[model samples]
Target chain A: MNFSYPEFLVKVSENCIKCRRCIKECSFGVFSWDGEKIKINHEKCVACHRCAACCPASAITILKYPVSFKENHLWTEEILRDIKKQADTGGKILTGCGNDKPYPVLWDKMLIDACQVTNPSIDPLREPMELRTYLGKKPEKLEFWHDKSGEIKLTTVMEPQIKLETPVIFAGMSYGAVSLNVHLILARAAKELGTIMNTGEGGLPQELLPYKDHIVVQIASGRFGVNLEYLNSCAAIEIKIGQGAKPGIGGHLPGEKVTEEISRTRMIPAGTDAISPAPHHDIYSIEDLRQLIYAIKEATRYRKPVGVKIAAVHNVAAIASGVVRAGADIITIDGFRGGTGASPKVIRDHAGLPIEIALARVDEQLRKEGIRHLASIVASGGIRSSADVLKAIALGADAVAIGTAALIALGCHLCQKCYTGLCAWGITTQKPELTRRLNVEEGALRVTNLVKAWNLEIKEILGALGINSIESLRGNRERLRGIDLDEVYLDVLGIKPAGR
Target chain B: MKIDARGMHYRELNERIHDAVLKGIKEIDIVNVLGQRYIGTGIGEKVTINVYGTPGSDLGAFMDGPVINVFGSCQDVIGNTMNNGKIVVHKDAGNVVGLSMRGGKIFIKGSVGYRTGIHIKAYKDQCPVIVIGGKAGDFLGEYMAGGILVVLGIFGREKDPIVGRFIATGMHGGTIYIRGSINKSHVAHDVSIEEIDENDLSALKNIIQEFCDAFGITDPNSILSHQFLKLRPKSHRPYGQMYAY
Candidate 1:
């Protein structure tokens, strides 16, 4: 019944000093004492490098297993493992974080263009590059009127806008999924970075109400903690239609994670499972979605912009346009590689399409219809670094949301065991003992440092393109070139093929 | 503050209502509120809204802390996702009553349309309760996860069924109490019907009295003459093993 096997082999180097630091620093309980020698438990190792990173004597060496099974492309080892796992647990294979299997990462296929001899590259160290962007609907046309007092005034109606010092915003992660300290760290980091962090379906906690302006509250099918105050307290509201990790499925946070604070924040009874329905019972169709969107607008008195987050399905272009026409000020598309606290492995590993093509399709569809100004498009899911961010922007995303990267900044090794409720790093678990591992002050600094570094790299890329502002690079697909891509992909991506 | 909503559009009427509420208007009397969708929605104040004519669907959806009093009936989806508020309908209401309601109380004087209190949820101290005075149509309290729903059948006792087919279908949590008896074929598979206990009746009395008082009932005991039936979900995680995680 034991489907689990060691994926890595624990190798002890000849330089072993017997300091036993590995025994102390290994959080996965991989090292133990057996009589005279320290015994290594290969079954417990998740290859997180905690012991290796902390080893002062350089005595610990971990190596991946040499061919767990005969590598058959048709019947891959993952498929066999999944089958075995199902047989062992007799339960659905639950996974966390993003899709870890090898798939086509479109960002690596497409390249960011820099100014060469034809154009002089601006030095980012000395020159100024603006990354500030406003996310919301923009007026298609402006009109002015003169009153009887002889004073002229601009009479154009404006959509509520969200101002971001940088194009990146932290994706919505519920309080129950992560610890309260993690939420505080994210809120403080976002405030310091002059950006926003979304409070997922869970409402804003009482202590985090002071950071309301930097938070974007969400309303999903479950309508968890979605009250007038919860909606009005945030800078914006996101109606979660779907997510990248599990596009068609709903979310079920187990009762074990619903502790006291989580219960209060989500406004549910403690030790009760929170089940988010797959679809909004009210939103039967696109028009139904429009009603909810306008309902939120009316509820907020039109003070905050409303965004709709959807997965990158096959019909993203049409779906994006529908969302825009339905009065959404922002459209967030989460690609197939998005992360989650818990999702069925079947959908996470094989569900939605890559975001690069989806973003290009949506942007082109909107621009071709001459209604691109109606909403800002945000790309998310698998944004790893500034290079990925730049690639996403060039493909037509106005901004990006990062979830897995933010978790990694707080020391997540991406072991993909997030559903187990035993994260030693304290990033995913809600248990007090495990959550206490993260120091809020240090975690906030790490998140801040990550954002700052990414921002600096973004500015450098924009400067190298001779573009002074990030806006100039948006939807400029011509500035990008595709490597080893066919004509169909190039046309779909709206980018020129290499050696054109 | 009193306003005539005879010819006003729903958006315009809602705007004026929001403006008045923002200006600290404690009470508002809206006359001729015909088909104005989402009345008093998003109004986050301790104000009272009195409606004269037929109001629209979603009358206090996502409402924070306002008391809505309707002199006439509501169309559909009343108290949809209502957070903490009171919606008192002096007459009968339409379909999907209290749909996904999280908290607060909804009181109706007469019969309701189909799918009353569907997905009515509750958490912690914020438990939503809906009291329908008369008979209800099909799928009453369908998919209800938390909170309480009571169909008094105050008027339709002899003429029709107290509640219609597929009652409490897909319900995982919460309790639904009908003033009279129910048939086994009309209920959902996951839910079970049982005799109302002393504690359940005691808890339901407070909610019933409030509903009766809203419609100016002389005696609450007369309505409690019939034995009550309670329907609750047998399993909390009914679909727990449907999908592979």
Candidate 2:
């Protein structure tokens, strides 16, 4: 009576050996051994490529299922499949990862400007390129006074700032959402790169305490595992207002997934559900948000920077302005295509604005209000490459946080089934047998390599533009030009159209 | 150490408290404390803070270990996300008291506003307890996952119910004890009401004894004379079946 169809067609070639290694490697139980040869259940194959990579004989060939229904554009195959699933289960369709819709990726529609004849591009190999950036509030003006001992001294107080070797940070990924091995890898990579990794609303585990200096602990509506010790141990704090993947909604980590380790970290019962409310009940107004911000500052003794993260919704500029005026040292804007552990398909695919437009509008609004220096902006969601990072900076972001990219670096094949808690590559699962597949040291090295490579690519881009410092490119919209984009987008991005 | 907080800004008052706590000063008496927010905040030491006047919102927020005794009424969010400590307010308080508090004990001598003791959770040995001496407003324990909440309704107005409407909405864990009968319309569907059992009576007795000790009440048995009703979540996972996956 099942009406669902297999998304992938997995075929084992004639080169198959009776090794049976694929059985242990496949976390989704897609392959089985019949005592003579290996049997494949193509229906269960998520196409994570874990078994394919581990197959010694190189026999597995996975392809998209090429059967179709009546060729009606209105009722597409994907829509029909979804309808069948709903009809069978009588449940709403749930999904993981970012939006898979055919929305325009604004980063691809923008081109970077480079120097040519008059201002020749400098070679990155020979010239010094400064990629070191700081994320925090900057003073409006510098004031200095001589001390009584005849020494020049600064009179204005300086706010706390987080230093980044490369303007890239690992976005918030909770330990419960991903594996502990993934958190370990992210922590190690952040340390090696001199950057930060955010502990998304889930509490920090004791094992990750060594990298506390390079970690940003998040405080969301749930207030999970948030205590004085948790606050004082981290380098910075982030008040998570909303994430782009599921804007205007909350998160629910089911009771079945709350293992002992996760329970200890989140400070909840071992088998109880951890529910995060959609909005912070205490924060009903901007003034209430300010109260919580100052409360955190007060608890930390004003020693650490506090950032407020919000999804890129309409009127994001005004919201960002209020957040800055509410005494946040940093602002993080998550675009519509942000990744998530689990979100309703309806909310994930159809909610929030793109980071490009939101970043530009927020930056311009903050600058127009003469309060741009009050807080730094960190753009997140759908930053794929070093080019995207550079382009995000030019679009008015102080830095960019990478979530999905970092997960990919740690061996996520993007099967979009992370909510099932059965990640084959050991990146997102809590099962002991699956989590063991991801080695901490090896995963850390891979992520570190990715970050280092991206750093070089960014330096090369900077040199091509005749800019030596990354800070020089921040909010420098003149260096960007739109291609095949409408006037409204171009106007909001504050960039000129090509051939203008 | 006795600090006079007259005409002092909240930042200055807090800084003074921090400086004193760092200097190993215990038992601070902050007098004339008119609307000073976040008093005793960030103080992890085993000191005592006694405030005389009306304090502002978020008193003892994120305070790990300390004892704060307020002589007058306080604003909203007192003991917000507090880890471990004791806060004894002699007068009435505002909304959202003891919000998201993981561990500690808050005893309000008089009534409180709406949403008091919301989202108070307990893990292992750390259970937060909030005891309201008088009636509470609407949504008394909404989204409460764990911990203990008791409303005595000792000083409530005549014919005004002990708590307002929509009590314990979205609550999945924890126990709520009210001194008198509850209005059926005021309770949420997710909670179940029952008569107190032997174990519940013992637990409530110990909590009421502590509440009596804090307010210097003469007869704890007299307060326990009224029949108490117990409220607990019918199911630990109220929304467990609501999700599709």
Candidate 3:
């Protein structure tokens, strides 16, 4: 029962007021007053800076533990600590919000091309640059009609589309994983930014019913809170096959977090674990997926577009092709390093591929098979900056979804303790006391500003490339060049070498 | 609206039904409805569909508002992912019935196959209900999230038993009422059996009367005399410790 392996060191300065404010503000029990003087428990500190930020005396400083395990390849500090923690507590190794391991990040190695003297780059401050994107299936060919009197008739039917003001959307995060206030903030931001935020498997809370048009409800294997009214209330429905954080694995939201509010929204009993089976029992094959797709289509009367979201596994190209062929109008691919409320460390660190490679391969395969226009591809998982968004579009993505970035805008330091349900930030936890830390109206304004700033940056990039619209940049791999990538990566990305 | 679905394809039949519904018809009767899959799939309308013969699988998948009455037996997935609706069968039913049904009611006159009413759920005011008059195969009401499932041993022989083993496996939510006793070996790990009480009996009787009226079962009073037992999940988080341990 004594498996305390805190990773932070707390230092109290001489300027301490002895007011014990740190003891009161620290949610993780890192600071305490033993009836006399305030004491810091280094073992309990997650370094979330809740106490440090709240302290009025400016007396507390926090740092990582200045200890080493010889730094050997066979015995890294993380490996040693993880083994010790499990051996002592006999608990599953839990982590939050994507892979934090030091893996090779390809986005840092790719560069965008700008126009030279041959083609003058337009000034974004004066020139008009469009960032709008439409997501849905486009027909392969258009039909033409002419009048009998030799006058051409202008007419064509268009399928439903998700028109995004900027090619950025808030990714799906279940209500169980985050507080209701977080959903509201993300919803408000999506509404203001002219994008969408997914109601990840948790179903839409009734309070946010007014923001239904900006919400994308999800249908995972668990079928939580899925009903006729809930399905009809969203802009679209996403069939969640897998997530990058834990591909091919199931999900279990602990019973302790399922309060009355979460229980009502998820439509499950309070204090019961909400478990999602790894796969949909009925959909064992692509044909079965097609059946469910059409079933939803039939249910909605073909009004809203239906989408499929999958993790970027090694063979994602072929899987995406099968998904589109199965009648999905939009495809969402989550790469490794995607965020999660809770996931096993082993799976989060080692399961899936990068979004860049997966996006390139899927687009190339879809284009090669003459089915590129069948569905719109939305890339997700670890899209950090506006530059990454532009690079994803160049690699052939209609849009991108951001999860951890949005949380950062909402005051998350990524201490990576979301699974513990004791978040110092109010974004992830369901506890009433902790969730009160967020001011949703202000948080929503911050998120809206963040996205708007990113949109302006995107327009700047487009203007620098002499491109006036985002559609012209879509799948234009010629504008991107690989720097550190070898021949195979460059070939798979279908881009030239940087020097070339 | 009437359709002679003899040897007609399911697509064409569905199209005709869709057109008829769009045309504002409130009732449709289909004759010779044999082995046609997805009969009322994805139909979101308040209407009545009367089927003369046995229909195929997925009778009302993702159905929102409608009533489907089958004069004969039905097949698998009678209400797969159905939201709000009602489906009535005069005789037995097939496998995997009511998979992930959020809200609705299903009544069958006779026995049913395996995995019936798996993952039936409820949200807010919408609670799904499924009632069977006779025996059932194994895994009945497995993984039911929130809803009501009832099985009556009216048509089964004394030795047949009401349902096969492993009933209510992984059932985290909901209640199952059964006439006659179930052996401890037949029950799932997470389920617990309890003696039926007054409120339970009243609810059971109400659903039984509805099922009797739908299936033309005479003397519905006979079902009240049978010893009814209730099965519910022992814990909402049955596997909470499995992952950590």
Candidate 4:
């Protein structure tokens, strides 16, 4: 007996010309063309709307299934559905994407300040607004001296920094989780935007080697495809300690998804589960992390900056500080709202801290320790729009990483069914027919447009705030205020109330 | 080139090695190398390095292509994530030897500490091989995905068991060969242990012959006379059934 209810109601309107396009367009197999007319099994609809959008007559309609259980606040339809699913399968309920629970979104509760007639706003249209940002360790102080020839030379040795035309970068999304076309799009967009795209755990394919200058290769616990060439062929190295979606848990990419190409790229067998353990078995302590970090530095001959990425947990500040002291040039803090291709639903919704509080506390703690300049902080997870990026920078991030938002720009409807390997948008699936639908050039253009629009909006907001440089806004919490937020959150965020 | 790293820091010693390699030095020897870490790290050249004294942790880490001959013992993580190279250790080594090594061959003349050969994997043709002349500590070959691991247990430690408990735990790929028998209770549940057949014996013979030649042992046939038990993961996907999907 099936105890599941349809989440969406699909209807074929009277305007249907019976083109049979819906049956072919829907990768989820929601619609079927009978001998007479088109019929829909609403249970299979993920609400991707590819058919509705592609229809010439616009005959298809998709609506949320107008059904409800008993009026119980504690046990909502989502809770009951999950319970029923577990009861039926006796397996852990898995989900994709970020936390969907209605926890407080601190970004919405925080407001940015604008200069009102006192410090006159700068017109970004005509003025030179600086958005060029560099990510890496900075020396505590700079010293310069005039040579005998009367030319000033820098005395302090500067560390390697990753220059970003804009402070926003594409987050790490692996190849097996998404298709190669998606990676191509990200790499192309990153090159055009002058920002790096992370190769999340999955190894960089041979074709993407041309974009090596704009790629940050990730080394996860699985150690998949991590070799000398892979390590050296990147702008920077990111040792992924944990992910925000599934903190303290390992990742298991099933054998079914491990195609021959994926196997070659990851350097694993063609049909084996790529299991990334919870922790790097050898890295048991902070000292061990230091050893690994220094080892990578030694391997790269100190050319590229090495970073450590950890989930934004309760003690994220301390952990980030340890990461910096352990010789990391960058620290990437991923919050609970970070997206994943697939993860256990229990951990996805319940584990890790929000990026807002995590970034603020980490910035505050590192500043107090007087080693904030030792490494650049990249705050990720749940950055929605340009306003969120600005707020993140003001709260203390040197830059921000966007994953879900970037996917949305590439036609992701956020149905959260990426685990099924049946993405109608062709963004997260590897099936040949589905993956071919995502034209790499079009996807790259969309991502490039999104980043450009966000960058322009950021400049507009900076002009209104009377700041011409993005660096001047970083860690400038005085330019921000908490709106209807608790005193504890305000204190942690290092901001006052809205009226103040 | 000869480097006397008596009191030199790991960084300086490694930098010297890097410089020597860059200078196209084919062969270099370091005498009195007392605990200098990351020796020959990331050196992709086909160079040979001979170490007189004990090297420090993470020796030959991420080394693409190089040969390291160690006269004395080594510290922990001797070949941490080593890519392609040959590391021949004369005596004992510390824990976590060959951790996550994708491609390489590590030949130890004597015993090794705990968690040796943990998480070592193999690519298409680049299969990593680790041969222990003596015994291995606990958790041997834990989480091994691909590659071959052989524990000879021939260096005067044959009275006790060859390997410690929880052998090949969570191992999904790879093959483990241990000379003599192992207590079945010590192995993981998903692994299968069986006596070597003709083909297995032939491959094991080649690996043993190489291990003996590395240490200049006279009797390769003596080690071959003993029965070898082969350990392999029962299924390629160990956690295939644990997931809901």
Worst 10 residues of 1 chain B by lDDT: B236-245
Q: Residue by residue across A329-416, what tens digits does model 1's lDDT show?
A: 9999999899998898889998998888889999999999998999999999999999999989888899999989999999898988
Separate DockQ for every predicted complex: 0.52, 0.71, 0.42, 0.71
> Which tens-of-lDDT digit does each residue in A1-500 have in candidate 2?
66877888888888988788888888778889898888988889889998888889999889987675778889988789888878777776788899888988999999999999999897999989999989998999999999889999999899999998989999998888999989988999999999999999999999999999999999999999898889988989999999999988989888988999999999999889899989988898889999999999999989999999999999999999999999999999999889999998889998999888899999999999999999999999999999999999998899999999988987888899999899988888899999988899999899999989999999998988999999999999999999999999899999999987
Query: Per-residue lDDT for A24 in model 4?
Result: 86
In model 3, which runs have C-alpha deviations exceeding 4 angstroms?
A: A1-5, A144-154, B1-26, B32-46, B53-57, B62-65, B73-75, B91-94, B110-114, B122-127, B133-139, B151-167, B177-187, B193-206, B219-230, B243-245
CA lDDT of A5 in candidate 1? 67
Q: What are the runs in model 1 whose C-alpha is more than 4 Å off? A: A1-4, A11-40, A55-58, A65-67, A144-155, B113-115, B135-139, B154-170, B181-188, B239-245
TM-score of chain A of each: 0.93, 0.98, 0.97, 0.99
> For residue A337, what is the lDDT in candidate 1?
92
Q: State the weakest 10-residue window (summed lDDT) of model 3 chain A.
A: A1-10
Whole-model lDDT values for every prediction: 0.87, 0.92, 0.88, 0.92
Which digits, one per residue and each the tens of the lDDT, describe model 4 over residues A1-500? 77879889998899999999889899999989779999889989989888988888999889989886787999889899888878877888888999999999999999999988889998899999999999999999999999999999999999989999999998999999999999999999999999999999988899899999999999998888888899989999999999899988989888999999999889888888898988997788888899899899999989999999999999999998899999999999999999999999999999999999999999999999999999999999999999999999999999999999999998888888898899988888989999998999999999999999999999999999999999999999999999999899899999999998
Pick the winner on lDDT between candidates 1 and 3. Answer: 3
Native-vs-model 2 lDDT?
A: 0.92
If you assessed candidate 1 against the hidden native complex, which CAPRI class would it receive? Answer: medium
Over A1-500, each residue of candidate 3 has an lDDT whose tens digit, in order, gives 65444678899898898999887777788888888778778998887888888889898999887764566897887888888877776777888988988888888989999999999998889988888899898977777788899887656677888888999999999998999999999999999999999999997899889999999999998888876787789999999999999999879888898889998888877787787878876677898788778777766767899999999999999999999999999999999989999998889999999888999999999999999998999999999999999999999999999999999998888888888888888888988888988998999999999999999999999999999999999999999999998999899889999999
Candidate 2, DockQ score (0 to 1): 0.71
Once fitted onto the true fold, the runs of candidate 4 whose alpha carbons sit more than 4 angstroms away are B156-160
